[model samples]
Target: MGFGAILDININHISTRLAYWLARNFDEKFDKLNVGKHQIKITSDTVYEVFGIPKGPKKVEIIADKRKVKKQEKI
Candidate 1:
């Protein structure tokens, strides 16, 4: 395969793993009742932050942010 193809595969693999990790660990943290149209931002190769609506009557007025560590960064 070409370099581009390999890079694409690697990216897909990383994203899939990240999704699974988030679902397993933060499923309840970002439930439908607490979030709407949630957004995830990757802060680094092994860290990511999530933003979403907070649960409550004023969900539309507030946004919740959570940061998670995926793996230790190399020194």
Candidate 2:
């Protein structure tokens, strides 16, 4: 329905299949797989780890617009 929900669904689907394949075939060759904005790592032969911050969003600062103040006229 929403963008976030759709993105999450796709991520889960792809990651699940990728993890399965990696665990089955290349468990010893590679340690991690970069899928989109996520990093899936193989911790052990049967253990897989997923982190959303490996290449996901970063810290950001929002700046507010400054308004110029008018000078008062001299009396």
Candidate 3:
């Protein structure tokens, strides 16, 4: 396999309990979760690997309007 990386997520169903636990133990400064015995790395890449991508139309925020409301000033 020439793939640069391989992900192995055994998530069969969602668990709110685990989510709450992780949230409580998560350290914002280090960006990791202290799972009582050890720490689990929680980076953006890891999150994407576990949850994959959203399956639906793109969600555009109101603030993300494409209208050119303000003209840019020339340097």
- For each candidate, the alpha-carbon lDDT, in order, equals 0.38, 0.45, 0.61
The most accurate candidate by lDDT is 3
Root-mean-square deviation (CA) per prediction? 16.5, 20.0, 15.0
Local accuracy of candidate 1 as per-residue lDDT tens digits, 1-75:
113333334331245565566665454443322134665433322121122212344433342443432343332
Candidate order (TM-score)? 3, 1, 2
How do the residues 10-43 of candidate 3 rate in per-residue lDDT, one tens digit apiece?
5444466665676789999999989779988877
* Candidate closer to the true structure by lDDT (higher is better), 1 or 3: 3
lDDT tens per residue, model 2, 1-75: 213333355331234555566566543556766555676665533231233323434655554543432333332
Model 3: lDDT of residue 70: 41
Candidate 2 residue spans exceeding 4 A from truth: 1-30, 45-75
Q: Give candidate 3 misplaced runs (Cα > 4 Å).
A: 1-20, 54-75
